[model samples]
Target: MKILITGGAGFIGSHFAVKMLKEQHEIAIIDNLHPYYSVDRKKQHLEVIKEAGDFQFYQTNLLDRDETINIIKEISPEAIVHLAALPGVAYSILRPLEYIDYDVKATVNVLEGAGMAGVKQVIFASSSSVYGMMKNVPFREEMAAGKPISPYAASKYAAESFCHVYGHLYGMNVKILRFFTVYGPWGRPDMAIANFIKKLKNNEEITIFGQGGSRDYTYVGDIVNGMGLALKNLKQSAIINIGSGRPISMDQLLDELRVYYPDMKIRTEKNRAGDVDRTWADISLARELLDYEPEVDFSKGIAETVAWAEQHEDFL
Candidate 1:
């Protein structure tokens, strides 16, 4: 299969690209290399992807509708894994409009381009944030995601609506995967695990928010595996969650970190805006539909992530 992965130089995108390349699939990546974090880091990711296998890399921003459409038409990929977006819930609170511009508009442009090119399938990466503070413990796909607390979540939900619209109009198969709290090697620096490690390494105090809220911390490998399965078996449009189905509290996360940082310091603060009390994904739908099961244990994943971060000190 010829696959076009947008934002293929980012953390999860790079992992997925490597997986596809190794599977002998022809891959093309579209990335703006936006300095949301570090262009140098993204370049490093591209280098790693190159080492995995040969692939076409297009430095195109999805925000440019004309260019995005033209590139898709030129590639004419059988499938598109749309992963480009400005990610960060807290950051979204500060600049909500940026989410509309980068997350919502970019996704619309991708769908538009895919529709124009008659692409067969589109796999959109949504977030657990869309669930908001549901009364239920484990969030299900059937649950209404109408009250997104953050602009980032709202934008993702809005983009998902566009996906269904495009799917209905163009007869394209769309798979929306709402990923849980994803963490792993080559992880984003802004994420909690990475932030804790960075702060600990620098002898700085790490702050715990909102009585140590829990999250279904899914590993990137599992998330990528779920996506691969979705690509193969999903014959129609669906909204499914790709998560570990195991919720880990912040205190538990810190305890895991203590194994690495015995002398790490900590403090407490109120929950930040746009933050949820907990996120637990009911991945039974994924299990039933795609035979998806998370393989990496949380402790093992954290050990590997910490080890990787230690080697790549510059990544922090």
Candidate 2:
């Protein structure tokens, strides 16, 4: 299959691209290399992916509707994995409009562009953040996600709704995957695990917002595999949760850092706005639909992530 992956230069997208290439699928990537993080880091990702497989890469922003459409038409991919977005819940609270433009508006462009190119299937990347601060233990796809606490979450939910609309109107088979807190090698520096590791290495005071709120920190490998499975068996328009079915707290994540840091320090602060109290996923739908099974254990994942941090000391 010829696949088009948006944000193919970022952490998860890059990994997914490698996975697809390994599966012998032809892929073309679109990425703006947003400076939300170091563009150099994204360039490094592109180099690594290029080493792993051959792919065509277009360095274009998704918000450029005409360009996005043209790129899709040029590639003429049978399927698309829409993974591009400004993705940070806390950051979204600080920059709501920017997030809306990048996350929501840009997603509309991708879906519309795909529709124009007559793409048969779309795998839209949603987030567990759409579940918001639900009191429920395990978030289900059927639950009401009407009250998103953060602009980031709201934007993802809006994108998800647009996916459904496009699917219903255009007969595109859309699979919406609500990703949990994904962490692993080549992880984003802004993420808690990576950020905290950086602070730990620098001997900087690590501030724990709301005591490092817990979440279902799914490993990237499992998420990528689940996405591949979802793409393979997508029969209709569906919203499914992709997670480990296990959630852990922020403090626990801190404690696990002892494997590397052994002597890091942390302080607790008030929770920031738009940050959820906790999140867990009910991935039964994914299990039934995609035969998705999360293989990496949380502690093992932490160890692996810490090892990556050791090698990429600059990221820390």
Candidate 3:
């Protein structure tokens, strides 16, 4: 199948691109290479992707409605995996308006383009942050995501709604996969795991916020597999979660890290605004729909991530 991946230069997007390419799917990528993180790292991801297989690369911003629509019309992919968005929860707190433009508006543009291009399916990459501070354990897709704590989360939720709109109006299959804390090789530098590893290597102190909340840290490989399954099995509009279904506190994560950085410096502080106490994804819906199961163990996933960060110390 021909697939178009937006933000295909970033962490999860890059991994997914390689996965699709390896599966012998025709691929086209659109990424503005936003400096929200290191452009060098994204470029490195692109290099790896190119080595995996041949694909069309377009450095186009999704915020440009006309250009994005034209690009989609030109590619006319059978499906679109929308992954581009402004990330960073705490950073979103500082510049909330940008979330509207980058996340919300950008998603609408993608959906608009997909609908206009007669795309058959759209797989939106949502986030667990949309679950907010819900007291429920193992969040379910049916749960109300109306109360997002961060602008980033709110934008994702809004984007999910627009995806449904396009699905309904355009007669397309839209699958909204809410990813739990994704981490692994080529992980985002701003993420907690990457930050801790980088700080440990730099002999700097790692800061833990609040009671050090837990997260269902899902592996990037598992995430890409889930997306592939969703693309194959989904026949209608649905919302599902792609996660490990395992929650680990910050202490547990640090304990795993201590295996490598036995003397890792640490400090504590109040939880930042828009931070959730814990996130645990109930992936039963995904199993029922796509037979999705997370294969990577948390300890092993962290080990791989640390190894990658160590190898790419300059990038980190």
Candidate 4:
């Protein structure tokens, strides 16, 4: 399959690129390399992707509808894996307009462009944040995601809506996969895993929010595997959760860090607005549809992340 990935230079995007390439798929990526973090990190991710396999790349933005549509037409790919967006809950609170605009409007451009180009499948990179503050333990696909606590979540929900509309009106096969907390190598400094590791490595105080909370931290490799399955097996249009399905608390995560840094410093703070106490994924739908079974356990994944961070100490 020939595929176009919108944010191919980022963490999960790069991992997915390698996975798809190994599966004998040709890839073309579009990314502006927005400075949410150091562009160097994205460059490093590109280096890894290039080392893994052959692929084309475009330094462009989907917000520029003409450019995005033209590139889509030029590529004429069978699938468009839309993963690019301004992500971060706290960050979104500070810059809601910028984040929401990129998340919602840019997604509109991608969906429109894909529709115009007659793309067979559109795989959306949705988020677990859309299930904000749910009382349930494991969030299911049928659960209502209408009450998002953050602009970022709202924006993603809107993007998912656009995807559904495209599927309904244009007869495109849309696969909406709501990703949980994705972390691993090539991750950005904004993410908890990377930031905490960097802080611990530097002997800086790591801040904890509200006795801390649990999150379903899905490994990037696992997410890539599920995403690849979604790409290959989009029957019509569906929304599914691609996650680790194992929720671990922040204190528990810190305990895992203690395996490496035995005496890591930490401070507790009030929970930030729009933050959820926990996130657990009911991945039964993904398992049923995509045959997706997460391979990497949290302990192993955290250790691997620490190893990668140590390997690239200068970057952190």
lDDT, each prediction: 0.93, 0.89, 0.93, 0.90
How far residue 52's Cα lies from its native spot in candidate 1, in Å, is 0.5
Cα lDDT for residue 306, model 4? 94
Candidate 4 global lDDT: 0.90
When sorted by lDDT, best at the front, the candidate numbers are 1, 3, 4, 2
In the range 138-214, model 1's lDDT, one tens digit per residue, is: 89998845899999999999989999999998999999999998999999988898888989988899998879789
Q: Clash number for every model? A: 0, 2, 0, 0
Write one digit per residue (lDDT tens) for candidate 4, span 110-149: 9989999999999999999999889987999878558889
Candidate 4 TM-score to native: 0.98
Error of 3 at 92 (Å): 0.6
Candidate 1 has its poorest 10 consecutive residues by lDDT at: 137-146
lDDT of 3 by residue, 206-283 (tens): 999989999999999999999999999889789999999999988899999999999988899998999889999998
Name the lDDT of candidate 3.
0.93
Models 1 onward score TM values of: 0.99, 0.97, 0.99, 0.98
Model 1, which residues run further than 4 Å from truth?
none
lDDT of 3 at 310: 78
Off by over 4 Å in 3: none
The sequence of per-residue lDDT tens digits that candidate 2 reaches over residues 1-316 is 9999999999999999999999999999999999999999999999889988999999998888899889999999999999999999878888999988998888888888888899999999999989888887888888845889989999999888889888887889989999998899988889888888788888887888876677999999999999999889767778999999988987678778876787777788898888888889998999998899999998999888878887988655
